[model samples]
Target: MMSEKILEVKDLVVDLDLDLGDGRTRPVLSNVSLSVSDSEVLGIIGESGSGKTVLSRALVNWVSHPLRVSNGSILYRGQDLLTLPPARMQALRGRKIAYIGSDPGSALDPTLPIGRQIVEKLRSVEPGISTRDAAARVVQVLDAVRIPSARERFYEFPFQFSGGMMQRVMIVDALVTNPDLLVADNITQPLDVTVAAQILRLLQDLQRDFKTAILFVSSSLGVINEIAHNVLVLANGRVVENQSVGQLLSTPQHNYTKHLIADIPRIWKGGPDTAAPAPAAAAPEMEPILSVRDVDRFYATKDREKLFGKQIVQAVRGVSFDVYKGDNLGIVGESGCGKSTLSRLLSCLEAPDSGQILFKGQDIANMKAKELLTLRRGFQLLLQDPYNSIPPHLTIGRTIAEPLLIHGVPRREVHDRVTATMHEVGLSVELYDKLPVGLSAGQRQRVSIARALVLDPELLILDETLSALDQVEQSKLLALFDRLQAQRGITYIYISHDLGMVRRACNRVAVMYLGRVVELANNERTFFDPGHPYTRALLSAVPAIEDRPYKAETYLLEGEPPNPINIPPGCSFRTRCPFAFDRCATDDPRLRVRGLDDLAACHLQEINVPAE
Candidate 1:
């Protein structure tokens, strides 16, 4: 039974200029053909620079900068989207085919109140609708996302909302008009696993209920396995493989797809810490390298809003964790859940509002002068966006060498260390002189890691560092981190929303929400038998690549995570928890041992022992 066709693209050829010393035109997407149906989710998986983004953008007349679609026929419902006039295309952008941009804030106007922005979307589609009526409609759409106080929040500015809330608002704005198709381009990368899963569930429900088609784009195969009915793999501006999700997962024809599937971590007979037999047992027991104790971080103003007064935004509520030598402590949470706040505190990039962060039993919050400079060598941070992390003006060599030079490493050894570190990150020496603009996203990320590693820090703080890298690059990098850990005992504080990576890469995992650690457990136990409601939600959200089908569980956590500022008393997760009771709202659960050195802060179960 063939599904009703919603969109079709045939022999799409997009041309762009290529500089061959002189100037010449080059075809970016050649003979690209694909289609989508009303009842199907299409997955576009690709490495960076594979023209996946370009091809997707071209669907909505959004060709990236300097890249124009010289030739392509994008048909929507038998109507040509490519040949449509500018005004017609603009009208079709939101009313018929919606786009949920990668950056939620940028997708929405920062200056406009979220409610007004959503209302404006309604008014745009139905110009005859009055402002009051549109406002009511806006509330209804926001309510669809289960955001609390929708009516009151209409006037709230985008900056006032957290990252997850902002994403929800963007989704509401996109869906308010009830578009036929939605294009989500890596929307969940900035969100934590729990919230990321909730968002995916919402999308799934919306797709099932509203019959909306989706072009879900992501670099993670695990995520694609969850939502996509069919998958399309792209690399270097070309399609590598396009098939049903079942075909792609069960028997991937491409080696790239196989690498992608293998990259996602799975539980073996033993746990994550169980070293390979080939590596022998020479590895020593790692000791505590960096410890964070009861760290609380917040951002706000001191003024009482002058006359009306200002309120302080609590980014990180009181939280505590540790990183041991050769250990990777994966902090998983949605964006704006204070994961980065904790990272900044550990790196001494930002100080906590309260509590002591002891590095080697010495408080780093109060480090001064030369001591601070010396302490920096012991810890370094690798950020998510490589473009922002590295100076575009500097060559790769200089970018990596700058850290060593700043620390007064000898000029002779600087080059050696930089080259060795670059190779460690899978970057070739030929790229040593290339600027960030000249490198691919994956290569640029490698440069970022190389720069961080050249300093020889005892601890590495990876803040979604591998988020932008493709499957192959990610696997190579993970292998590199593993080798570095085994050889040098370098500890890591890995902060990411991707659970698959966390499961494969980290020794232990910590789940965070609204500025607190909700759960902490080993990788195997965390996935197979989650102790906390939030942890279970996160695990259930992760899509497996194996043959098993996905079951939609009703363990729904409603409402956007509570505002960090003025967070409700007792359990922070209670407002959205499906199992929460009156007792949960009054008494906060302390972190306590449950099973096999695992700890979770939830009142539902005092001691949860995993089934054999």
Candidate 2:
């Protein structure tokens, strides 16, 4: 017997109200068609601005103001939802067809307890359910999504939760109603690899138990490959290819689909020191550009309102490293591993509690404000969220020119620099007057790059700058970075969880864990022969591109990192290190030479026992 169709979108066309003086509409999605069967997984894959998101919203008749489904029939359970009454649509939206948006923060209520919000959701769908029973259900769903101590956590406000934990709460909220079709839109985009893998496993388990049809929308093919049975590839608001996961990945038909698949950087495999041909003997003469020595930064939590007391958070602890003038040093670690804080220190945006940060042999803290301003023009930071990084209200011209103007460049020179920079970064000159909201994520990121390059910075501190982007855009930007480096001899300190991109872009890599660099080496040695157990675990968490039986690779970390407020004694990573012994608990291992350039902090290495 054939399974019933749960949802079907036919010849869907969505348009955005340009709100131009003439009141014209621009088509965002054009002639898209797909269906989801009972207990089936339909994956939507696309680059940013490809209408993957718009189509998902359009399916539920939930397109916001200025954006509407102009042409299409959205059929749900054999009923055309476009013609359904508002009241009927409302009834089905939350109870039968639930939506968990990409950003978990948007779905949650800040003032209300997470438990209360979920219980409210439960009661809305099932009015006869008691408050006690609703809360119990909330707790059950939370546990199902792997929220530890779900019963106690239910009472906590969303502010108390981490990004990953907040995401778990959102999943629980969506599933509490047991919706027939769950629309999970890029739910794991903001997560670390380990957390993302866990969430994927949770979803797999939930599907097995509930047998609910799911529309899994994401940009990551690796993710789609693991979860979805079939994928619909979208580009320029139109369907490019629709095929089974295996067929689509192995043999993508369209050029757009092929480019998207090919652009995925293979982790630890293609670096110069790996399978790729080595570069000709490198230039040796160099004084260090930035030398970070025994840097310590502590953050004290405001404990005035807390019941217990205030706490001291050690964000970066005695971190030391040297960055050469033309070096592209990559920092890879989980979210709380102090990589971001260390980046700030390196950029001279924050002061360390102790130790010296020398920029060209001059101390960052000791430099005069005027001198520091001049120095800062040589190094700029590019953040993860391009939208938030550039002020929304500012025109692109003004946004790019702000840095140039601030640096005392002539007005004419500022204009010239901004224009040249914009063109260099692949942005149209016509967008100069447009607000950031009108631009795509890739365009906005280009604006960011243009702004940074306008001042001709010698060093760029990229803190997850490409994490928010789709693969196609990442490929373009990675190429841009490479070109910029080659042309200007610029340096880059890349702080990212994307090991693949890191290996592809950087010659050297640093692995941090709980505010310390546990491993340091060239990207190839660090990846292929990782000495630290934490580094190995991170690599394992990434999904394999091959058709190996896809078991979630957790490698051996049992739990999340210990809270920075009260880190354990001795080696910080010992708590999760599988080969850790009593000595690991008492003696903190320092970076010891494993190779001419490779260094790792591990007792196993010191004892000359190779990690499996």
On lDDT, the candidate that comes out on top is: 2
Q: Relative to the true structure, how large is the alpha-carbon lDDT of every model?
A: 0.77, 0.84
Clashes per candidate (backbone, < 3 Å): 9, 0
What's the lDDT of the predicted structure labeled candidate 2? Answer: 0.84
Query: Largest TM-score belongs to which candidate?
Result: 2
Candidate 1's C-alpha lDDT? 0.77
| TM-scores of all predicted structures | 0.89, 0.94
Cα lDDT tens digits for candidate 2, 117-198:
8888788878899999999888889888877788888899998887778888888888888878988999888888777777
Shift of residue 259 alpha carbon in model 2, Å: 1.5
Which residues of candidate 1, in runs, are more than 4 Å off? 1-3, 19-23, 121-126, 267-287, 302-314, 546-554, 604-612
List model 1 lDDT by residue over 1-612, tens digit each: 778888898888787867565657777888788999996899998766677777878887788545767665888999888788888888889788988866876777778888987787788877999999988888987888867788878888888776677888888988888888888888876666656667887788888877899999987776787788999987667777999988987788988778667666553324435322222212345435676778788776655448757778888876877666667778987666788888888888888888988877788898796898888888888999867888978888998899888889999898888888887778899888787786777777878778888888788899989876766677778888888877776887789877667877776789888888988877666766667787766555565564221233545355567667678988888887767778788998888888766888888766443311
